[model samples]
Each structure stands twice: as structure tokens, then as C-alpha cells.
Target chain A: MAVREGLLALLHEGPRHGYQLKTEFEAATGGVWPLNVGQVYTTLDRLERDGLVGVSDNEGQKVYSITVDGVSALGAWWEAAPVDEPPPRDELMLKVLMAIERSTERGDAHAMSVITHQRTVLHSMLQSKRRARSVATTSLAARLVTDALVVRAEADLRWLDLCEAQLNGTPTRKARS
Target chain B: MNDPVLELVDVVKTFGKGSTEVRALNGVDLAVSPAEFVAVMGPSGCGKSTLLHLAGGLEDVSSGRVRVAGRDIGDLDLASRAALRRTDVGYVFQRLNLLPSLTALENVALPLKLEGVGRREASARSLDALAAVGVTEQLSRYPDDFSGGQQQRIAIARAIVVERALILADEPSGALDTMTGDSVIELLSSLPGRFGTAIVLVTHEPRFASWADRVVFMRDGVVVDQTASTVPVSAAGAAT
Candidate 1:
């Protein structure tokens, strides 16, 4: 979805062929999100089909440009916050849910064990990220990414603690393992 | 292994007596080596503070032994315990406990002064301790004049000024904002490597506790779990 809108935003700057859009997108995001030429062309084809982009030929290459409607769409995209839409399918959450169901059916303690294992793994990851954050030589982009990961991992650990508390019928407190 | 700077063997601590008895700690065993940072984590009323108090010689154990620097605290007289506290153990509280009337340098120097160190030598050591925590410029400022982070750093400097082997911190970062709290935790975590100070910290926040070399979890007056931290304590040749 970001790539789709990102291509539009790139074309809005100036008319660019497929290859140019791919290169510019990667460059703009500090190479964090690499784009493939085929994917770019496919997205451009869809945008043109929807009348959000116009195609022109220059020097035997097709140049894509954002249409008036595309500009309005980009404006709306900029103004509106990104919605989760389908509410991202987090694999860890799915796995934990399945583990809980299976543990209950088998009368086992596998669910808590699974949570504990994941928390240890996440805790180790959090420690490394924290170390990276503390290093003065780390880049701002790397630092920001680590910070986000740390926050997410902390939140996930808290959720796992909450799940354990609920399963054991213990009162939930603000501070947790 | 070399003797741990702090050790508790089957330690039990109780409050009141008879029918109103409350066991704050029951059969707790812990050992912390010099330069090792250990975090004690648990829910409220779970004996975390009691364990810290016992280790710091602030409270008497009802049974078993509490040792610091290879000496059993229970065998020490009141004056000997006080002298040991002055020279071998430091406590950092959640409130910092800085004297409002004293400057940062003076507050940090107070411990050494109480130990009967000369004024000049104590002040010089206090300045070095303050500089170690990056608070060199705030030496003359009173606790009220410094930011929460600065005040905590000064408190840390005070804790380490006597060059104590064991530093007991009870929620040292509890009163600061998350960022400041994290920096404070980072400072405390670094001390084990920088000064060979064994730290036993009690905190409910796992985020802060992650800074330790090991974490001990308590529940119902006993240690329920223990885990080693992933972050390796710098290889300073200190024994585990």
C-alpha cells in the first residue's frame, strides 16, 4: 500500500519512468524499502487503469505521471491517517491463541511455557536493541528503528504477562514481569 | 569462587508475632559477586524490599545468615554494623534522600565525612564520583536546583563516593520520566564495570530490570524465578 502511494508521490514530483520511480522510492526512504522494477510497473499499470496516472512515451520509454485525480488522492492520503483496515494479522498473537486452545484441550501447561519462551526471546532482542540505541555512533535511522522495536517488544511482553495472569485468575497489575 | 560481596543463605525475615505474624521473606538464598548487577523484581508485598534491606544490613534476619564482604551481618554489633554500612554498603532510595540544604558536592561528600575522612580528601573524592556520572558541572548546585536526572546522578555519586562494594537501590528510577529513568538505569548498570560495585536493585519495571546481569523474581515471600540477562556484563575479570 505504501509502495502504491509512494509511486504516486514520486510521480507527483515529476514525470518518471518505471525504473526512475523504483530508484527514487528506495532513495527517498533511505533504502529501507527496496522496490522491484516489475512491482513498480504493475502498480503503475493499475494506477493508469484507474485513471490515477497518465502514461506518455518519451525516447521509446513509457513515462508515468500523476493525473488530477491522482493528485487529489495523494492529498487525501497525506491528510488522513493510515488505517489498519484488516487489523494486521500478527503471527505471534495467532500462535499464542492456538497454543492456549491446544493446552486447554490437552490439559497441559504448554501455553504458559510458550509465553515464557517468547518473552525470553523478545527480552534478548530488546537488550540488543537497547545496546545499539546507547552506542553513540549508531545512525539516527537505526536508532529510531531500534527504539520502535524496543517499544513493540515491551508491549508484547506486557500482553504475554496479562495473558498469564488471566489464565491463572490472578489480578492484573500495571507493573508486570 | 571468590566470596560474593553480598550473600543471603536461607534468610527469613518476619514482622510482628503470634497470630499477627507476617513473613516478609522466607528461606531466600542469593549471592551477588563484586561488579555483578542483580535486579530483584516482584509484585507489591512480595518481599523484594525485605531482601534488599537484609542485604544492606538495614534489617535483622529472623533466621539464617546475611553476609556482606564475607562477614555475616547478624554477628556484627550495632556499632560495627553502622561502621560497615558507612564503609562497605550504599543505599539509593526512590526519593534520592539528598539533603535539600546541601550542594551536590557536599551531599556526595557527606558519607565520607561521616566515615571521618578529612574534608579536603572527601571533597576531592566526591568531585571524582560526580564526574564519573557526568555531573561535573552541577557540583555546586543544590538538589532542588538540579533536574530529576541530575539529582539521581548525584544520588548515585553519593552512593558510590565511599567506594562501597555493594550498592542497594530500591526503585532508583521510579520517580523519573521514562527517558530519564532509562538513562539513570544505564548509569547504574555501567557502574559494575566502571567501579566494580555490586548492585542489587529492586524494581517493578522489567524495562529497568533488563539492565541487570541477572533478574530474581519473588512471589509470596520467596524467589519464584531467576534468569540471566542477555546483555553480557563487560568481561572485567569479576567472578560470577
Candidate 2:
């Protein structure tokens, strides 16, 4: 969804070749997600077919521009809110639930160990993020990326703590030294 | 490993008599080395605070030994234990840390003052501590005039003023908002590297506790488990 809208957003600025959009996307995302030039052209073809973009020959090369419809689409994307309410089904939730279920079935304490292990990982991640925060000195995008990782890591640890509290009925496994 | 600045050997703390007794800490053993960061976490009534108090020699241990900077606090006299607490220990509570009557400089300098250091030398040392925590302005202002986050920073400056071997902080960021709380934890995580002092932070929030090098979890007056940050779990098994 973002890739499609991101292309339209880039065109909304002005006309650009496929390579320009590729580089711009990389720069904006801090090079976190790499985009293929072929895929960009394929998506551009679809946009042209849908009347969302116009192609032109500029300096013996093809350039893409956002049409009126594309502008409206980009505007709509801005107004549309993302869904985050119901706590989307994610891998961590699945792992924890299964670990607890397995522990109960086998009369063993597996979940707390899982929780502790996950917490330790999150803590180490946080430490690295702390270092990154200090080093990500100049660019706002890079700084925000690090901040996002930090908060996400923090949230995951809190969820693990919640799981530990809910499973307190089970005896805590004596942690390994 | 460097020698532990604080060590609790088979520490047990209890309150009241037989029928009305409540065992706060049950045979907990922990050692925090110099320049290490340790956090204690648990449910309510889990003796996290008691563990912290015993570490700082704020409360007497019912049995076993408590050592600070390699000296046995239990073996020392009352006056001597108090002196140890003053000279070798620093505390940061959730709130009410600073004296309302004193300026920020005086509050940080109070620890050195209590050691009978001269006014000139104490003020100079206090300024350095304040600078270390990134506080240079408003030294003349009282604690009441500053925001909660600023007050917490100043409180931290006081804790490190004398370069104490151990700092016991009990939910230092409990009262601040998310961003402010995060900055406080960030400042604390920098302590071990900046000052070479050991830190024992007692907090229920894993977000704040995640900054520590090791985290200890307690239950029913017992140290149930602990996790160290050295070996992070595979990033492939991430979170929600």
C-alpha cells in the first residue's frame, strides 16, 4: 500500500524517471527498504492504465507525473487512518500463547523461560538502540527510526511482563544460572 | 569482573512477630560490581524495595550479611553503618527527593557537606556533578521552581556528587511522562560509564528496566529469576 502511494507522492512533487523514484524512496526511508527498478516500472504501468499518472518523453527518456486523480488519491491517503485498535495478530503473541499452552500440557514451566529469554533479547536490543541514538546525530529520519525501534522494543518487553503475570498460577521455573 | 560495590549474602528481612510476621526478603543473594547496572523487578509486596533498602543499609538485615564497597555493614556499629550510607551510598526515590528550602546547587552539595567537606570544595564538586547530568542553568533556583524532570535530573546529580560506589534508585521515573521518563532512564544508563558507580534500579516497568545490564525478578520474598542483557534473543523471535 505504501509503495503504491509512495510512488504517487513522489510524482505529486513533479516528473521523474524510474531511477529517481528508486533513489528518493531509499533516501526517505533511510535505505531501510530497497525497491527494485523493474517493480517500480511495473507499478508505473498500472498507474498509467488506471489514469493515475502520465508518461512523457523527456531528454530521450520516460518521465512519470501524477495526474489529477493521483493527487486526489494522495490526499485521500493522508486523511485515511491506519488500523491499530484490535491488536493485530503478530508472531510474538502466537509464540507466547503456544509456549504457555505447551508448558501446561506437559506439566512443565516453559513460558516463563520464553518470557525471560525474550526480555533479555529486548534489553540487549534496547542497549544497542541507546548506542544508535547517541550516534544517529544528524538526520531526523535516522533519529526517528531509532526512537521507533526503542519504543517497539519497550512495548514488547511490557507484553512479556504481562504474559508472566497472567501465567503466575503456574510455578516459576528455576532459572538457569 | 571488578569487585562488587554492593553484595547481599543470604539476606532475609522480616517484619512483626510470629503470628503477625511478614517475611519481606527470603535468602536473596546478589552482587553488583563496580560500573555495573542492575535492576530489580517484581509484583507488589515482592520485597523489591526491601532488597533495595538492605543494599543501601537503610534497613537492617534480619540475618546474613550486607556488604558495601567490600566492607560488611552488618559487622559495623550503628554510627558506622550510618557513615557508610552517607559516604558510600546514594538514593533516588520516586518523589520528594530534594529539600524544598535549598537551591539546586545546595541539594547536590548536601552529600559532600554532610561529609564535613569545606564549602568551596563541595560547591565545585557539586557543579561538576550538575554539569555531568547536563544541568548548567538554574543552579540558584530551589527544587520547587523546576519541573518534575528537571528535579529528577538534579536529584540524580546529587546521587553522583560524591562518586559513591552504589546508587539505589526506586522508580525514579515513575512520576514522569513517557518521553521524560525515557530521558531519565537514559541518564541513569550513562552513570556506570560516566562515573564508574554501580546502580541498582527497582522498577516495575520493563521499558525503563530494559536499560540495565542485568534485571532481577522477585516473587514472594524470593529472587525467582534474573536476566542479563549480554545475550540477546534472536531478532527473528521478535514482539507484538
Candidate 3:
């Protein structure tokens, strides 16, 4: 989806061939997402089929440019909010819940230990991401990527803290190791 | 590498005796080299605050050495420790960072004045400290007139005013909102480079700790781990 919108964003500037689109997209993203030339052409085909792009001949090679409809579509995409995939990739939370259930039966403190260990790991990850951001001064895209990771890790750490707080109710908390 | 401005070697601190004894810190070792920023992070009752207290000489260590500017604090008497704290160490707390009645310049100059410097010279040095923290406007304005973030900056200015070898701040960002707290932490992260003073910050928030050159984690009165950030700082050394 982003590739389609990204191609439109590039074509919004002017006409470009498939390889040009691929290189420009890679450079624009600071090479964080290297797009194959084939992928670029495939996305362009879908965009052209959807009337978001118009292809023409520029000295034998095909050139793709944004159409009147493409500009409007890109504008809407820019303004629209990003969506998170619901109920997806929540493996950590599931593991914690299952661990709590078993730890309750076994009378062990393993669940809290899991939370503590994850907190340290996430904090360490954040330190690395923050370090990356500090040194990525030359590339805005690289810096932004680290910024995203830092915040996401911070959010996970907050959730772990919340789990710790909700624990310690005697029945569930002091399940001795 | 520069000599550590502050070093805690196998330090221990306990409150009360025998039956009711509370071991606040049990065998923690840390070193803060010149112009380095170290953050101590842990949950409550983890001895983070106790460690800062010992580092600033506000409290004595029980069984180990705390050396500030190369002198072991355990060997110093009360008067000598007071003088050392006055001259070599600075402290910043979460609240009451500045006196309400004193103007910004006076707040910054308070430490120098207590050190027996002349009023004119103290004021001159205080002005530079204020400027270093980017507090140039309204030197005559009291702390209440400034915003919370500005107030924190002034408090930091006071801490750094006297070229103290080290500054120990305990939860300095604990009271502010997220954005304001972030700005304050940013200011602290810049201090080592601009002032040549080592900083040991005690905070539970990982966000703030991420800015430090190194972070020491405490658990149940023990130093569980110390990790160094990849951010470049002077005298980068291995964490123990």
C-alpha cells in the first residue's frame, strides 16, 4: 500500500521510469526500504489500473506520471490516519497471560520474572535505538526510523510496568520461585 | 581517561541496627568520569536515592569507599565532608529548586556566596551560569515568575555555577509533564559537554535514562547491571 502511494508521491513531482522510481524511493526512505525495480513496476501497474497513474513512452522506455485522480488520491492518503492491524502480532501478551495461568497452578513467580526480564530487554533496546538516533544525524529518514522504534519500545515498557503493578495481590504475586 | 570525579567502590549503606535494620544499599560500585552522564535507575526502595545521597556526601557509606575528586569521603570528618560537598559536589532535587524570594541571579549565585566569594564576583559567575542554561531574560525575576521548565533550568544553573566536579540530581524530572520533562532531560544531557562536570542522575524513567552515557540498574540494594549507551561521550569506558 505504501509502495503504491509512494510511487504516486514520486510521480507527483514529474514522469519517471520504473528504475528511476525504485532508486528514488530507496533514496527517499534513506535506503531503509529497498524496493526492487520489479516491485516498483508491479505497484505502478496496479496504480495505473486504478487510474492513479498514466504511462506513456519517453524515448522507448515507459514513463509513469500521476494523473489528476492520482493527485487527489495522494492528498487523501497523506491526510488519512494510519491503521494498526487489529489483534495481530500480540504474541508477547499472549505468552504472558498463558504464563500467568500456569504459574498460578504451579505456585511460581515465573510470570513476574518474565515481565522483569522483558523490561530490561526493552530498555536496552531503547538505549540502542536512542544511540542510533543520535548518530543518524545526516539522514532524516534514518533518525525518524529510530524515533519510531524508541517510542514503540517505550510503549511496551509501559505495559510491562502496568502488569507489574497489577500483580502483587498475594494470591498471584508471592507464588514463590 | 580522566580520573573519575565520583567513585563508589563496593559501597554499602544500612539504616538502623540488627532486628529492624534496613540495608539501603549493599555492595554497589560505580564510577563517573569527567564530563560523563550516568543515570541510576530502579524501582522504589531499590537504593537509587540512597546511592545518590552517598555520592553527594549527604549520608555516609557503611562499609565501603566513596571517593569524590580523588579523596575518600569515609576518611573525612563532618566539617571536611561539609566543605567537600560545598566545594566539589552539587545537588538538584525534584522541587524547591529555587528560593521563591530570590531572583534568578541570586538563586544561581547562592552557592558561590556560601563558598565565601565576594558578592560582585559571585554575581558575575552566576550570570554566566544562567547564560549557559539559556536563562538570559529578566535576571531580576524570581523563580515564581518563570515557567516550570525555566525554573528547572535555573535550578540546574545553580548546580553548575561553581565549576563543581560533580552534580548529583535525584529525580529532577519527576514533577514535570512529559514534554517539559523531556526538555529538562535534554538540558541535562548537554551539561557534560558544555560545563565539563560529571553528572549522576537518579531516575526510574527509562526514557530519561536513555540519554545518559551509562545507566546503572539497582535491585534489592544490589547493583544488578550497568549498561553503556552507544551515544558517543568523552572517556567512553566499559561498564561493570
Candidate 4:
């Protein structure tokens, strides 16, 4: 979520204090763009540093009003990039890989245990993803991200099954390593 | 009791072209009464979720009739069907899909507001829904702040808050620990009578499936068994 430019645009609506800005942003965007208090301050400081917003101190409280440049930046960001698509990183995969190392030193039992747990978790996740897909009433980018997650989760599950088979000393791939 | 809230007759869903195709659902038949709770169980790829989707109007069936509140879903135009879904169906998924930014109350209220209810009224009804699910204290908190059980409660609140006739939940309690899942199941099983909403839940856990007033088992896209047990069926009965 782009916080700075979006926050700046809200300031352009009127000169407002940080807390009020956060509250108004939440209400204005229908609770979609939630602003944490700390993040609101940090973004405001950066905006002032960049000369995109002018800060006025009144009664020991700082009020921020959007500068012309801030308005332009907000417009630019809105036009250029309304959504962010980050790459997928599987934290579970990392944990599973670590377990595989432990199993190599320990015993097949540990590896089998890991695989079993992952199977249960993946099955749950897949069902959840299917439900989410069914009721998705949101942006295209969000739906795409969900689709990617589901496919990746399913692939990890298939790979886990293969690992489980190998760990069990099944007669596949000629022989176990 | 005479007119079912939802009815699926010999539903079939297929994916891909002839030779390389897969039959996701095969000749499934089911019905849910007003305010009834039904759980669907099947192995992965057995079409339990497919049945839920057909009932919710998320996907169309290859063949068979899907009716919600006496209107055939297949007979409606795309826009009309979408409207029906927005107003008549509320869905809960295994993963809590609550928008992170929205407060619990707002997340619950989004559906009402989307359908053109005023903000104050939407918020008020959302608060009532949150209260019903026992999440009233967490009203202003975002989804990330709460535990999994609480989030699922909020999701449930969202599903039935609009007084939708049907709520389709796909593995609503699948993500949590056993204790939390049980709490969620209790919360879900209670809503039908409280809100007068029919529900179809897809789940793999027998304990979770047991929460339903009825259970329908599917295999290879067909409903193999259907039975109704009064509320609070024995654990052994659930396992079977």
C-alpha cells in the first residue's frame, strides 16, 4: 500500500493534525486505507523533508497541509502505480527445508513428521483459498495474488508427497539416496 | 420447510476439453432448508468445494439446476445473478479474507455498504453482527490484531450480518488449532437459528463436519451419502 502520496492527498483536502488525518483517512477510504499512528507521523515527516507538505506548529502541535508538489506526486502515483505486486516467498518451505536437514542427522521419523504436518496445513490452506476465490469481490491484482498463492501451495504439497514417499523407502526412483 | 432455501439437482462441473478434461463434480444432488446447517465432506478433489461453489453461484454447473430462495440461478442474467449473490449469499473461507485495513466492524459492514446502505446504519448493523459472534469488544480493531479464532468470528459475522438467506463457508474452521476450531464451529453452528440463514460448509475434519445439522459425503464429484442427525450428534456418529 502506498502511504506517503495517499496521505499527502488527504492533507490536500485540508490542514489537519496527524491523529485527525489518520482518522479521516480511515473514514474517507471506507476503512480500506488504515493508517497507524506511527506510520502517519513518519510519512508526514518524510513529506515535509521532501518539501511536499508544509508543517505549521500551533499550540505545540504540528499541523500538515499539502504543498503543490505533494498534490502532483499523489496524482503521479495514482496514475502510474495504484497497486503493488510483491514476489512470493514461502516461509513454510524454508522451515521444511530446515527439517529435512535435521532429519538427515536425526532419523526418518522427523522428516515424516514434518511432511505429515505440512500435508494437513496445505490441505486446509487449499480449501480456504478455494473459498476465498469463490467470494472474491475485490481488485484484479488481489485475486491474481491469491491465485498465485494457491498454485504455489499446491505445488509445495505435491513435492512434499514425493518427499514422504522417498522417506518411506518406497520403490520409486530405483533406490533411496 | 416446504420450499428449500437452496437446492442442487444432479449438478455436474467439468474442466478442460474432452480428452484432457477432469470432472470436478459428477451428478451431485442436495438441498438445504431455511436456517439449516449442512456440512460437506470429501477427500481432496472429491468436489465438496465444487458443490459449495455451485450453491453460492460462484461457478456455474455444467448441468443441473441451482435454485436459491425459489429462483433458478441459471435462469438469471449475469448482472442479476451477481446482484443475488451480493444480497443473498455471504461466504466464509478457511483463511480469513478480511481486508487487513478495515476494522472488524467495517469489514463486517462492507457488504451492507456495497449494497447502498448508509454508513451509520451499516456500522450499526455490523456492530450487532459482531455482538452476535461475541466479538463486540474487538469492533474497532483490525483483523491482524486479533487471534485466528476472533478473526473467523468476525468473518462469520460478516457472512450473516446482511441477513443473507444463504451462507457458504469453505472449511471455515480449518486453519486454527483444535480448541479454536471448536469454538469457531460452535459459533458457526449457532448462527443459522439466530439469523435465520441457511449454511453450506465444506470441511475435512469430522469434528467440524459434525457441527452441521446434516452431512453430505461426496466422492468423485457425486454425493455418495446424505444424512441428518439432530444437533449434538455423538463423536462416534461424526467419525463414521
Highest DockQ: give the candidate number: 3
Q: What is every candidate's C-alpha DockQ against the true complex, given to 2 decimals? A: 0.32, 0.35, 0.38, 0.01
Give the CA lDDT, 0 to 100, for residue B165 in model 3. Answer: 89
lDDT of model 3 at residue A3?
81
Per-candidate TM equals 0.81, 0.88, 0.82, 0.56
Misplaced by over 4 Å in model 2 are A83-89, A169-177, B229-240
lDDT of 3 by residue, B100-209 (tens): 99999999999899889999999889999988888999999989899888999999999988888899988889999876887888888888888888889999888888
Cα-based lDDT at residue B60, candidate 4: 91
Whichever of 1 and 2 has more lDDT, that candidate is 2
lDDT by residue (A1-177, candidate 4, tens digit) is: 667876887887889999998887776554545779999999888889999999999899998999989888878886894576533436666767788778776555566566666665565565565456546786655566666666667577667756755655543222443
Better of 1 and 4 by TM-score: 1
Candidate 1 colliding pairs, count: 0
Model 4, span B1-240: residue lDDT tens: 346788888888999988989999887667677777878876688898878888878899899899988899999999988888888988899885799999988899989988999989998898888888998695888899999899999998888778888889998788899769868987887877688787888987755655677766665687655553443423213223
Best by TM-score: 2
Model 1 per-residue lDDT tens digits across residues A1-177: 678898989999989989989888876764567888899999999999999999999989998999999999999999888864542326779878998888777767787678766666666666666666676474565556666667777788788777766766632222232
Mark the 10 consecutive residues where model 2 chain A has the least summed lDDT: A168-177
Model 2 residue A25 lDDT? 80
Candidate 4 residue runs with Cα over 4 Å from true position: A1-177, B229-240
Instruction: Rank candidates, TM-score, best first.
Output: 2, 3, 1, 4
- Deviation in Å, model 4, residue B52 alpha carbon: 1.0
Which residue runs does candidate 1 get wrong by more than 4 Å? A6-71, A79-81, A84-118, A164-177, B230-240
